[model samples]
Target chain A: MLEAIILTVITAATPLLLAATGELVVEKSGVLNLGVEGMMVMGAVAGFAVTVSTGSPLLGIVGGAVAGVLTSLIFAFVTLTLVANQVASGLALTLFGLGLSGLMGESFVGQPGIKLQSLDIPGLTTLPFVGKILFGQDILVYLSFAAVFGVAWFLNRTRAGLILRAVGDNHASAHALGYSVIGVRYVAVMFGGAMAGLGGAYLSVAYTPLWVENMTAGRGWIALALVVFASWMPWRAAIGAYLFGAVTVLQFHAQALGIGFPSQFLAMLPYLATVIVLVAISGNRRATLFNTPSSLGKSFVPDR
Target chain B: MMRLELVKRAEKSRLMSVLSPVFAVALTVVFAGIVFAAQGHNPLSGIWYFFLEPVTSLWGVEQLITKATPLIIIALGLSVCYLSNNWNIGAEGQLTIGAIVGSIPPILFPDFVNPLVLPLMLLMAMAGGALFALIPAKLKTSFGTNEILTSLMLVYCSNLFLDWMVRGPWRSPQGYNFPITIDFHEWAVLNAVDVGGIYLNLSAPIALVLVVILAVVMRSTLKGFEIRVLGQSPRAGSFAGFSNRRMTAFAFALSGALAGLAGMMVVMSEIGKLQPVISPGYGFTAIIVAFLGRLNPVGILIAGLVIASSYLGGEAIQTSLQMSSKLATVIQGVLLFFVLAADTLILYKVRLVTGREGEGARA
Candidate 1:
């Protein structure tokens, strides 16, 4: 029972970890893409549709990532090139993604989905709790951990990452230093989009193994909050995602246990927890300012 | 590969500012046509059903007005919030809470059948919305929380609360197991005015009055100037003695009140009773309305009608073309993207540069 619960929590946390990690990079690059939810939903629908058509969950995941990249490019063009308000453009991207995905997935509703299978090593498959907990998970679960460590390394140890961070911190300075601010931001935004897509694909192909309109159901927004709770650190985001996943799983368990409270109220736990967590994290003015990218969410236009 | 570059203008272009929305609508229509064609339908017929057929009949026009009323009211309040630089994205929650609070007089005190019940309900709803909105405002002022996330989070909480209410304590005895409340008494309902054989709800005129009042306030009041100054530059606003904290609270409360009023109107005029769900995403849709209207009261009113028609058109296509009503949401989203993109033309000139010449110049 304990191992089963842990596995469920990991499954739940993987998507959040995936998305929050991507958003952390985007914010570190000084671009706030509010459309994580949009890209995510698009990925979910596209991933599900492709999986259904191709009978391969692997291709579906890739299709979802590509869909996210394509969606993020629209945002890139509007904000990075046209220099539109990043906040509004992000909101537009979200609304567009939600609507477009719903329309696209209209036919896929109520269809039985093919779940992504878990990995099985020859000898490790029959091992007790620890082995199953660590080695018996699906491919995306492993990828999520790899992504966190990869992002942590990329942000701290890489020269290109330093350039990306520099652009986010002070675009004008980075521009004067001969780095392409818009180019770096575009890559960051697209990366964020791809990660969000992967997260969404996991929802449709692994977590629930079904296509539902707005299946993301505010997870994208929660991922956004996770970035803040982590103070923009990749590893911290992983911890935050797992904590939220625990809360979510515990709530479901409580509902199953018939604790007598209304299920609706129980359902409110994650969202309420998010608000409380945000207050606690952002309440520290010095800490928040210490880590937040100076140029985050501000539009950049390079002058020749 | 060709790349797009923007060069800032010395001053905002008046012509482009006025024409941006028009250009956005045109662009959305064209893209919508392509979407329809891609789905194995005639693009022209899809356009006709999606945009034109909804407003051709008197009944259709009534439905348009009915839908536009709440959107206009909600957008008007949002304009104030946006203009003051307060991002109140949780108007949907405010609306839900407003509907609940407004329904109290009717559901709890069904025996109270005086004209005063309606007015009192409206006031209670506005107060409910304002107070609910102040949650994020207070958090921002005290804890310095990000209002956007807090506000949005509250939406889910409020929605769940509403669902709990209808399914539990507030469920009507006579609702036949449906998750709904009892029918509201006549005094609690908003009546329609018959204007020469055409019936229009009282909420329509109320929305219009609000638009006019807000237009005047935004145009001439010192408060309006304060909102504008703060939004443009918080430094200048502080230097000029306008309090950012107070402005945040004020903007949120005002928008919340308006959203509450719209919610009350929706319950009183349309639904006529409380239910598990009261709105069809009107609060969020109003955000699109607020932007498409350029954050102006009169412009919002017009934009509200345009969007409301889309809702009708979505239904029309659902029946005529067998398309999902979600197509309306797609069109609205596309329209917003174009609006944001086109507004760029107001302040900058976009030029397409071919080849490495532009890249070399930048380097």
Candidate 2:
């Protein structure tokens, strides 16, 4: 039972992990894209629709990423190109994506979704609970772990990573140093969108195996909080996602076990947990105590 | 190019002001046409049915108001918060709480059909929403927590609480195990006014009156000036001896009260019984209405009407064209994109980049 719960946590956290890491990258570039939810929903709809039509889970993942990127382009154009307020533009992106995805996925509801086939490694599959927990998962689940490590390494070790970090930290300063802050941000935003989309597709293709209206169900918001809970660190974000996932899964398990608490109240437990974590981590300083991109949520407009 | 331009241009004329939202609609139609074509539909007919059918029918117009009433009220309150530079993203939660709290009056006092009961319900809704909002306000003022996150996170709590109430304590004994409350009595219902050929609810007038009152308060009052001052520069506000704590609390409370009013109106007019899904994303949609209205109460009223049309039209298109009603949502979202982009032109100028000149401009 404990092992099953552990497996559920890992499976549940994977999508959030994918999204939060991407948002971390976007925030690092001094842009706050609130459209993460919208992008994810678009991915969910697009991935589900395409996967249903094509019968390929891998194509669905790609479709989801592409859909997210396309939806994010609206945000990029508004905030980056037009110099609209990042927060407001992001809100618009979300509204647009939510509406668009709902429209597109209306017919796709109640249909069976193509699930990503789990990898079956001979040696790895032969091992104990650890092997089953780690190696015997679907492609996206493993990729989510790879993404966290990849983002961490990229943010810390590489020169390109430094440029992206600098763009996020202080766009004006980065521009003064001859780097294209807007260009870097545009790229980062698109990447963030792709990751967010992939996360949503994970829900439709791997986790739920069906499309539902607003199926992301504020997981995007949870991913947003995870960025803060992790204190904007890549590795911490992964852990935070799992932590949230564990809490969410526990709520379900509790209800299934017929625990004393009202199931409705219990259903709200994960969101409440997010608030508590947010309050605990966020302080008056308006800066993360850990390594946060200093210029997160600010727009970078290049002049001509 | 090296010189400073008038960073502040005069506000658009009244004609242009009205035209802007219309223009946004036109832009939406154009983009929506493209979207429909992408989805393999005739663009012109699709766009026409989207707007014209909803307006032509009496029933369609009624649905529009039914859909729009909560949006306008909620957006009216949100304008004040946005203007005060306080982003209260949890109006959805406030609305949910408002419905939960307000329902108590009708549910508990089922035998009492006094007019005052309705008023009390409204008052409780305002208080509930205000009280819920105060959590984030107090947190922001004391712990310096982000009100955006706190308020937004609270929405989930409120939703769950509402769900619990409907499924548990608040569930009607005679409801036959359904996840809802007993139907509200006729006295509890918000009476619809018969206006010439069409009928409209009292909520419309209430929303319009509140919009005017808010506009007057925002434009003509000292408190309004203080809110504007505080939003633009907290330091400047403090330097002028204005209280940040007081203003922050006021902004949040006021916003919460409006959201609560929206809740009362919703329960009174549309959904007579409390359910888990009482609000069909009205709280969140109101944020869009608020911004699209440029955070002006009057602007939000107009924006509310326009957005409300999309909801009505979305349903119309779904049934008529066999297109998914979700397309209406997509259209509204697309409309928001155009409106935001158009708003940017009003606030800032976009310049093209050409090689090293862009680099020099940055420096």
For this target, which candidate reaches the highest DockQ against the unseen true structure?
Answer: 1
Kindly provide the TM-score obtained by chain B of candidate 2 when compared with the true chain B: 0.91
lDDT of 2 by residue, B1-363 (tens): 332211333563555445556677788889878876876888878887777778888877778877788899998878778877888989998888877787787798799888887788888999989988998999888776778778988998888888888888889899899888888887787877888766888888888888889899889999889989998899999998999988889888888888888987888887788988878889989988987787888788878988898887787778778887777777777777777766655645444556566446445
Per-model chain A TM: 0.98, 0.96
Mind giving the per-residue lDDT tens digits that candidate 1 earns over B185-223?
A: 999998888876557988999999999999999899998
TM of each candidate vs. truth: 0.99, 0.94
Q: Cα lDDT of model 2 overall? A: 0.83
DockQ of 1: 0.87
